[model samples]
Target chain A: MKIAIASGKGGTGKTTLSTNLASFLAEEHEVVLTDLDVEEPNSGLFIEADLVREKDKFKMVPEWSADECILCGNCQKVCNFHAVIQLGEMIMVFPELCHGCYACSELCPTSSLPMIPKKMGVLKHFRNGNLNFVESRLDIGEEQAVPLIKQTHKYIDQQFDDNFIRIFDSPPGTSCPVIEATKDADYIILVTEPTPFGLHDLKLAVETMKELKKEFGVVINRFGIGNDDVLAYCNEEQIKVLAKIPNSRRIAELYSQGRLIYKEIPEVRAELEKMKDLIMGKMKEVVK
Target chain B: MKIAFTTKGTNWSSAMDPRFGRTEYFLIYDDEKDELSHYDNRDSANDAHGAGPKTAQKLFEFSPNILITGNGPGGNAATVLEKTGVKIFIGAGEMTVKEAYEAFKGDTLKKL
Candidate 1:
């Protein structure tokens, strides 16, 4: 079953939950963990997966030929991103703003604009025993994450097996990258805190999941630090409360040191196992 | 020479808008014809992206020789305006469109 762990607010322990859950599941079942947070992928830091392979990610950008080019300005006119611009006798192309749509090349009357590949990021494959970890790391100053995330998902789809329990650690917020990560998920575990900010963002994420018609449950991290507002909201919305991980200094310290809490904390491990059982039960119901 | 000013209102008395892409209106003043006109720029105000170049394209349609505004045009918009050979002037923040145009004529506004 393909499951995604997501949160609307950042630093709400999504990596913590996803990494621990994957490690726990790997004990008895084959697991594939993908860090879809291309901007800042840190789950690999906690897991001892050996880098098996790597591949560069690329996006198509317009390359203009000045010799065959007529400065008709049609390319600039058709470019919604303003990536292509005509300056009198000169034409400038901003590949950073280009969305790789190839509309500019199609609109060029002289056919002087050719689409070329530009490096956007890299995808890495790692393995440790029964656990396989895949990560997408975007290059510095890169604004496009959705494309890289989609590529990473495509990689997962190609390599995914029926026996593998796929867990995707999605980026924070209900943005395009998050959608790309969670679109194919059979079940999404929405992680959140009990604070007001967490509640507000969780509501946004819930709305997004509802719109996408995806089955999702809530996991409240750092549960006792704040009030029961998140649980109250979940109850009113009829959303399932999968687990509530207590806020502990030991876990925080372990996390800060890039250690998996499930390995050291029996309580966290038990909660993750329970959450896994709940997800498996839900999957069985769907299969039935 | 035709001059364009990013403005909050239709008239020359309106304050110059600092944002080119999200400006409420663009006032075009034709010095040769002694005519003044306004184009509503509200369409691009809530644009999710590429508002700068889109607004620059709209302003280019008026064939303005000079653009006076509160802030410098962004990279994309600057590229479009530069292609059209339109000179940009900044430092219209505290001045109304008419006052800014006067300052431009008086060679007081900072050229961008």
Candidate 2:
């Protein structure tokens, strides 16, 4: 089963929860901790993974040969993205605006358009014991993370069958990149706190998952610190509270020192173990 | 020649509203004549994407030799305007239409 741990607000315990959950599950199952948060992935910090493979991700842009230029404005008309342009005697393509749809090339009368690859990012695969850590890093100054995330998912060697347990640590927010990461998730775990910002963004995250028609559960980290608004909302909405980790400075210290919470707090491991069973039960309920 | 400045709207109704998309009160100062004239653009509503070619087509109706805006002129829009021999000034933040005209006459219109 593919599980996604996501949060709409940053600084929520998504990475913390994902790291411990993947590590805890790895002992009994063939696990893949895929960090889909390409922009700022930190899952590897917790897992002792060695980089095994690296590959480049590319985006497509329009390429026109000067010799075949008819200067017809047809290419410019069909581009819904406003990416193509027809100069007096030339056709030019902007790398950023092109969505790689190739509509311009199809519409060009001279058939002068060809796709040129624009390198966007790199994908790195790491193996540590039983767990596989996959991360995609966007190139510096690159604006798009969608292609890289898609590339990372595509590059995974495993076929999409209900076999191994896969936990995806997704990027924050309900933006396009977040949507890209969580779209194919069979189950979504929204990690949130009891803070006001957490509750506010949690609603957005819940709404997004509802829109995507994904079965979701909430995990409240820092459970005792903030107000009860999140619990109140979850109760009103009938959203299940899967697990809760009380706010502790020791947990925060362990996290900053790159230690998994379950590894540090023996009691936390038991909670995560129970959390996994709860998740399994919830998944069965939804699928049935 | 007259040009119009209309901010993007919030909804379909506002976007389609003729009063919201085009301005008839635009004043263009002809450098040679040293006088402001009523400049209007009536086509901003017809185009979507709000960039490149669509924007150029809307601005072309005003017969503007120059365009000043925050977004850099380029892509399909810039190419079309340049084909008509119109200069594009990107990063024209907070500058009113009259100020842009003065900047154009003084040869200070920065190219995108």
Candidate 3:
């Protein structure tokens, strides 16, 4: 089953939960942890794995050629992105604005615009025992994270199957990147804290899931610091509180030192076990 | 000669809006007609993406020979303006439309 651990607010223990859960399950099952947060992938920091393979990722954008003797404005009209514009006998293309839809290129009578591949990021695969970790990092100054995230998803789909437990560490917020990461998820784990900011952003994420009509549950991290507002909200909304990882100084210290705590901390490992059981139950229901 | 200024209001004394893409008002001055008019840019102000190119397209339709603003247009918009033969003069920072127009005439403002 494919699972995605996501949070609307940053630094909400998504990396913490994902890394621990993946590692804990890898002890017995084949697990692949793919970080879809291309902008800044942090889950690999905690995974003690060896590099297995790496590859470059690319995105296609139109290149406008002023030659061929046609002054038609068709390129700009068909380009909904405004990436292509006709300017007094000259056709200009903005690579950053192009969505690679190929409307302008396919519809152009003169074939003045040709789509070309542009290097956007790199994808790396790592392995440790039964666990496989994949990370995609966007090149410096790259603005669009959705394309890289999509490419990473494609890689995961092509390499791993339903037999291998897949967990996607999604980027923060309910933006386009998050939507792409969790769109095909068999189930979603919405990670949040007990604070007001956490509750507010969690509501936004909940609304987004409702819009997408996906089955999702909540995981409360930093559980001891904030009030019970998050739990109350979840109860009122009929959402399950899957697991809770109490806020601990030791957990933070070990995480800061780039160490896995599930093996060292019994309570944290028990929470991961709880999450594993819940996901296993959901997977059975899905198969039924 | 026709000049366009990204401004906060409709008149010559209106304050210049630094950004070209999301500026509130675009004031066009036609030297031959000696007439000034305003074009509202708020239609695409909340646009999700490509606001720069959209604003540049609007400026292209106006057929201005010059554009003055606090900050110049971005890469995408710059391409459109450059292809359309619109000479962009930036550094109008915090100047009124009348002052900016004088600065343009005196060649004091920097060209983008």
Candidate 4:
């Protein structure tokens, strides 16, 4: 089964839950956990594994060639991003603004604009026994993350078959990156805190998930501390509550120390078990 | 020489918008012809991204010799504007279109 653990607000235990759950699941079945948060990937911190392989990821951007020289200004007209523009006798291509759509390059009458691969980030693969962990991190100063995330998904798709139980740790927010990470997952586990901030962002994530028409459930982290508004909201929406990880000082302490809490904390382990069981119950053998 | 001022409105008395990418209007003052013209930039609001570059592309049609705004164009927009030889003058914060034009004539606005 393909599952994506996501949260709308940052610092709501996406990495913590992913690392613990993937590690716990790896004990019995082969599991692949890929971190889709290209900007900042923290799952590697808690995962103790050997380096298996690594690959550089790139995205295509248009390059202008003055040699081909037909100043028809077609590239500028076709480019919806405003990445390419014709100014007087010169044509300029902004690599940062280019969405790699290839509209400008493909439609250029002179073939002056050619698509070129630009290194955007690197993906590292690590393994420990039955678990395979892959994390893609974008180069600093990179404005876009969706392309890198897309490439990461491609890497995961190529490396693992539908038989492998794949889990994705998605980025925060209901924006492009989040959507790209969870689009193909068979089930999404929305991790959320019980505070007002968490409730608001969770509503956004819920709307986005509903828009995508994907199967999903909720897991409320630090449940004992914040108000019951998040739970109340989830109840009203008729979404399943997969598990509620109670507020615990030990869980926070272990997590802060870069340790996976499932092995040490009984409460966290029970929550993980509940989540795992719920996922397993609804999952099909080839669900992806 | 033609100068472009990002303004809140078309009139000379209108305030110069501090924002370049999402400016309401671009008021052009033709030094040679002593004429005034304006382009509505309200359409930029619909752009999800690249507003700066889109604004620069729109301003390019006016072929302004200089662009005077509160904040200068960004990296992408700057590249397009620079190649077209549009000198940028910034730090015209909260100045009216007419006042900013006079400031440019007096060489007071900071050239970026």
Total backbone collisions for each predicted model? 0, 2, 0, 0
Q: Point to the candidate with the largest TM-score.
A: 4
Candidate 1 clashing pairs?
none
Please state how well chain A of candidate 3 matches the true chain A, as a TM-score. 0.95
- Best lDDT goes to which candidate? 3
Where does the lowest 10-residue lDDT sum fall in candidate 4 chain A?
A279-288
lDDT of each residue in A56-132, candidate 2, tens digit only: 88988788887887777787788765567665566667666666778877777777898889988788888877787
CAPRI classification of candidate 3: medium
**lDDT tens per residue, model 1, A1-288:** 889999999989899998999988898878999999999999998999889999999988889899988788888888776677666576778777778888989888888989989999999999999999999999996777888888888898899775688999999999888998999898999999999999999999999999989999999999899888999999999999999898999999999999999889888988998987886776576555
Q: How many residue-pair clashes does candidate 1 contain?
A: 0
Better of 2 and 4 by TM-score: 4
Q: Which sections of candidate 2 miss by over 4 Å?
A: A157-161, A282-288, B1-95, B99-112
Question: Lowest summed-lDDT stretch of 10 residues in model 1 chain A?
Answer: A279-288
| Segments in model 1 whose C-alpha atoms lie over 4 Å from true places | A66-93, A104-110, A282-288, B102-108
Clashing pairs in model 3, backbone N/Cα/C closer than 3 A: none
Whole-structure CA lDDT of model 4: 0.89
TM-score of chain B of each: 0.95, 0.50, 0.96, 0.95
DockQ order of candidates, top first: 4, 3, 1, 2
Question: What is candidate 3's lDDT per residue for B32-84, written digit by digit as tens?
Answer: 99999999998766777788888898888899999999988987787677778
